[model samples]
Target: MSAEASVAAANFVTAARSFVGVPWRHLGRARTGLDCIGLVLLAAREAGVDLPDPAPYAREPQGTRLLEGILGHARRVAEAAPGDVLLFRLGLYGGHVGIASVHPAWGVPACLHAYAPRRQVVEQPMDDELRAALLGVFRLPALET
Candidate 1:
C-alpha cells in the first residue's frame, strides 16, 4: 500500500473498532445500531471517504450490482490489512461486507461485522475457512493526512 492508503487504513481501523458492540439493525447506520453495509459506510465516512449511499435494501437483495457499486469507489487489494473491506460469498448470495481488524483478545487478524444472527457487531477470526469465503478485499480512497 502507498503512504496515503496506509493512513486511510489506520484511520478506518480506529473508527471501525469503536463500533464493535453496536446492536445490529436492518438498514441502520447510526452508532446506536448498524448493519454490515452501515458499518462500512460509517467507517469510510469517519476516515474521510464519502461513499455513495447504498440503495434501500433487504436482508437478501438479489440480482443487484452491489459488489460492482462498491468496487467502483474502492481500490482492490491483494491482502487485507486492518481496515480493509472484505467481501464475502455467503452461499449463493454475495453482498456481505466486513471490516478487517486485529482481534482484541487473540491479537490476530479478524473481521468486524454487524452480524444479523448475532444481533450485534462481533469480530470473527479470519481463518482459512473464512478466507475461502472471501470474494475480494478492497480499500477506500486514501484519506487526507
Candidate 2:
C-alpha cells in the first residue's frame, strides 16, 4: 500500500476503534453505541465506502443469507484484495461481516469487525475458526483521490 493507502486505512481503523467498549445496543446508531451491523455500516462509511441500508432483517435469521442487503447489494466474488468486505458463516444462520483490514499474517489474516454485545469495533484476528466460517469476501471497488 502507498502512503495514501496506509493513511486511509489508518483513518478508518482509528474511527472504528473509537467505538470500542460501547454497550451493545440493537439497531443503535450513536457513535458511542452500536450493534454489529451498525458498527460495520459506520466503519464502511468512514472509510468512504457505501453499503446497503433500509433492507429488512428477519425476526430471526434463516438457514442462510441472514441479511437481505448483503444478499442482493454487495457483490460476491472469489478474488482477494485490500479493503474487501468479508462475511463469516458461523452456522446455518449465525453469520458476521467486516472489512478486510490486513492480509498475509503468517497464518490467519486480520480484519476490523464490530461485534454485538461489545457494541464496539475490534481488530479481531481471522483465525482458523474465522477462516472456516468465511462464507464470502467482496472487493469494495478501489477508490482514487
Candidate 3:
C-alpha cells in the first residue's frame, strides 16, 4: 500500500478499536451514546474514511435487503480491508452498516462494527453466524483506485 493508504489503514483499526465496551442505544454514537449506524459512521469519519452521512429514513426506501442495498452501492466484500464498509442484519428486521475496522486486542481478527447494544465499536469473531448474516463487506470506492 502507498504511504497515505497505509496510514489510513492503521488508523482505521486503531480508531474503531478505541470504541469497544460502549453501550448500545438507538441513534447514538459516543461511548455513552451511540446506535449501530452512528458507531459505523463515527469510526469511519474519525479514521478518515470517506462515506455519506446517514440519510433520513423517510427519504430512503425500507424493505431493501441489506445485502442488496450494500452490494448494489458499495464495493464487493472480497476487496474489503480494515476501515471498509460492513453490512449486516440486526436482531430481526434491522439491517445495519459500519466501518469494516479491526481490533488489535482481539488477536487481530478481521471485524468491523459498532455494536450499540453493547456500547461502542467492537471486534467480533469472524465465525459462521457472521458468515451467514453478512450481506457484504466493502472498502471505500476511492481506495480501490
Candidates' TM-scores? Answer: 0.87, 0.68, 0.71
Highest-scoring model, lDDT = 1
Candidate 3 or 2, higher TM-score: 3
Identify the superior model by lDDT, candidate 1 or candidate 2: 1
User: Clashes in each model (backbone N, CA, C under 3 Å)?
Assistant: 0, 0, 11
**For residues 76-101, could you state the per-residue lDDT of candidate 1 as single tens digits?**
78888888889987667777899998
- Residues 27-107, candidate 2, lDDT per residue (tens digit)? 656776665666666766887766676334553456545455544455567843445567776456545666665533443
**Clashing pairs for predicted structure model 1, backbone only:** none
lDDT of 3 by residue, 1-145 (tens): 4667667766766777677677666666567866556666666678766555454442123654423433345566564567676666665543666665444566544665666455555678667776666766766544444
Among all windows of 10 consecutive residues in model 3, the one with the lowest summed lDDT is: 58-67
Stretches off by above 4 angstroms in model 3 are: 58-61, 64-73, 91-94, 106-108, 116-120
